[model samples]
Target: MTTTPARRRALVVRGGWDGHKPVEATDMFVPFLEDSGFDVRIEDSNAVYADREEMDRTDLIVQCVTMSEISPEALAGLIGAVERGTGLAGWHGGIADSYRNSSDYLQLIGGQFVTHPARHPDQREGGEADNFLCYTVDVTDLGRTHEIMSGVEDFTLRTEQYWVLTDDLNDVLATTTHPVQPYHPWHRPVTTPAVWTRAWGKGRVFVATPGHSLPVLRDTSVRTIIERGMLWASRTASE
Candidate 1:
């Protein structure tokens, strides 16, 4: 008799601000997760966090909620689940920008989105420059050997470069530098993590800061990193 492998269960909780296009963003990745052998369940409401039984059975949680308040009961359930080994992964403001009022949530995530300095648009008519800045993402030496970042190399990206407030516990995989432009107050370039991973209790946490827009998320390199990061966080190998 042949033995069947147990399907990994994933719960994607989306919806907070429509600006993040949480529904559309979650739609983009659901198929990938399904193809990766996960039995995926999606909830447009954060209320799902209150279901301790469901949370306990879940193997992974992919959250796309941005700037929303999670109820105390639900928050406790989610935190307890992750602490007990349910993996968590998210990109951009979904994880970092959510739950601004909860210090415990911020500590669990290991970072928070502070700001993205806007670039000055050229006064010249049709000059082609806007707040979106172009920068390079360089993989760190440690990242070169990590499963999530192994094949990814230094690449240039034109998008919102996030200035995040991070903790020392993160295992940084890649980084980008923010140049001192006239639009910003800083006199010197500020370097920040573009991709990183950390452990929360027995669960793994993964974050990437480049997915502000659909096009950015669709970028080949960005997509690859997120896909790999998700698998790594879930403690699964791609099929």
Candidate 2:
């Protein structure tokens, strides 16, 4: 008799300003996680961390959180879970730019979204703005060989070029440069890490820069990269 494999579990927490596309983006990732054999739990409330036991058992944590202050207990729980080998993956500012007041969150997540020298990174800065700019993404040394980026193609995104400050230890997968910075208050030419990864304890991190728009996630290259990240980040659980 064949026994069914234990089902992998994932939790998604999302909420913030409407402009971050929180609801819409969270909806998009649900099907993907479900397709990947995850019993997905999409939580509109950030209080999912109230249960430390639940967080401990999760195979992956896909969060769309942005611009909020996560309590210390919640932050510690998340870090501890990942360190115990629960994969952590997300895209854009939703996960990366989340927990604004928590430097501990930023450190655990590997990087933060600082400035978008172009139009707003999500193009919702002024509202009703849809004009786009295209730029090339360069794959770096650690980028080319990582499983998360194994089959990803370096493609351009017709969206806000994110300017991020990343640590030297991060496995940077892709980068894009913005020449429009001269018009802004920031004086230097900006080069953002379009994609990157770093380990938080025993768990792996997979992050992408293309989730700024719902439609942009439709890009063949963007979807491919995100898909790979989910699986790659979840490596510990699968093993």
Candidate 3:
């Protein structure tokens, strides 16, 4: 008799401020993963894993939450699962900007989104907003050679150009830029790493700064990027 491989499961957690668009945005990933053959388990609260033991069976974790304090035990449980090789993937401030109050959290995730230099406090994509920028991103690293970006040509996307960023142990997979304050030390002419990947432990991290809205996430290029990111970071055999 032939043995069947177990189906992979994905844990999707969503919550926090509405501005993050957690509900609508994360919902976009549900069907997407299903199409990929993953048995997705969607949860709106961290309490779902409160059992403290449920993390054992989970294979991948995708956080869509903006900002929500987790119990020490709960936080540790989540991190522990990822450390054990479960995948951790998300976009925008949801994952990168998450747990701002926890230094350990920052260390585990790799980077954070401090600010957007060229972006005004209130603006829309392609509006009359000054310095609003968008450009085609070049995926030159080994990440592009992989199946996720395979056949994905250099694509164009319009996001409030991220002028505020930090450069450390980051693998810049894609980039773009907008002008910032001329007097400041970093007020030079350059585009930044708009999409990147980093490592934490035995696990992996995939983050994209372009998911400012459902429309952007829904774009053909953006969707492919995030999907590939999930598979890349997840602890699945395909990775």
Candidate 4:
């Protein structure tokens, strides 16, 4: 007799800053996860992280919360879960800009959002659109061969180009350059990781710095990368 295979479980935790539109952003991917044969569960709070019983059963985590505070217990549970083999994947501020207070979280993800320098002089008054700029995302040599980035040519975007602080631990897949302009104080052009992955024990982590808005997320290349990333980061039930 043949036995049925168990469906993989995906936990989506989203909330925090409204500017990132966490709800709408995450909603875009739920259908994809379902189609991919995942048993998807979504929570608006990070408090779910502390539920070790659920976390232990999770195969992948898709987080979209931005600038939110996670309790110590929940944070610890999250770290423990990932270290134990639960995959983590997110984009833009949803992952990079969330939990600023936790250095441990930063260490796990291997990157953090610093700022997005405004491109237009007239629009530099702190609105979201002020930082929008036209830039190219160049794939790295390693990216040319990696499963997540292979065959994906360098692409350009007219959106927020994130200036992120990252470490050498990340396996960077693509990068975008922040050009030096007279309006910004920085003297030299800064090139930051646009997409990357990290290996945390048995779990995998995937992050892309381009999903600042729905339009950006909807970009053909961006959407493809994120979809690939979620699949790549998910843990197999047998594993």
Highest lDDT against the true fold, candidate: 4
Q: Candidate 3 residues 11-114, lDDT tens each?
A: 99988767769989999888878877789998988766555566766777899876667777768887787787778888887887777787766766766677
Question: Roughly what TM-score does model 1 have, to 2 decimal places?
Answer: 0.93
Report residue 33 deviation for candidate 2 (angstroms).
1.5
lDDT accuracy of residue 22 in candidate 4? 90
TM-score of each: 0.93, 0.89, 0.83, 0.96
lDDT of 3: 0.73
Candidate 1 or 4, higher TM-score?
A: 4
**Worst-scoring 10-residue span by lDDT in model 3:** 124-133
Candidate 4's residue-wise lDDT over 1-239, tens digit each? 99877789999999999988899999999999999989999999999999999999999999998998999999998999999999999999999999999999999999999998776587677677788889999999988999998689999998888899999999999999988788778899889999999999989999999998899999999999999999999888667
True lDDT of residue 118, candidate 3 = 47
lDDT of 2 by residue, 1-239 (tens): 99877778988888876666888887877888888788988887767775789987788888777777677777888888888888888888887788778888778878888865555455546553433567777777777787767766677777766777778768889888877543456666567788988887889888886677788877788877887888778745345
For candidate 1, write residues 11-112 as lDDT tens digits: 999988777789898789999999988999999888888899998888889999998999888898888888878889999988889899998889888989
Error of 4 at 145 (Å): 0.9
State the weakest 10-residue window (summed lDDT) of model 1. 122-131
Q: Which stretches of candidate 4 lie above 4 Å from their native place?
A: 1-3, 123-126
In terms of lDDT, the poorest run of 10 residues in model 4 is 119-128
Error in Å for residue 73 of model 3: 1.9
Off by over 4 Å in 1: 121-130, 235-239
Question: Sorted on TM-score, highest at the top, how do the candidates line up?
Answer: 4, 1, 2, 3
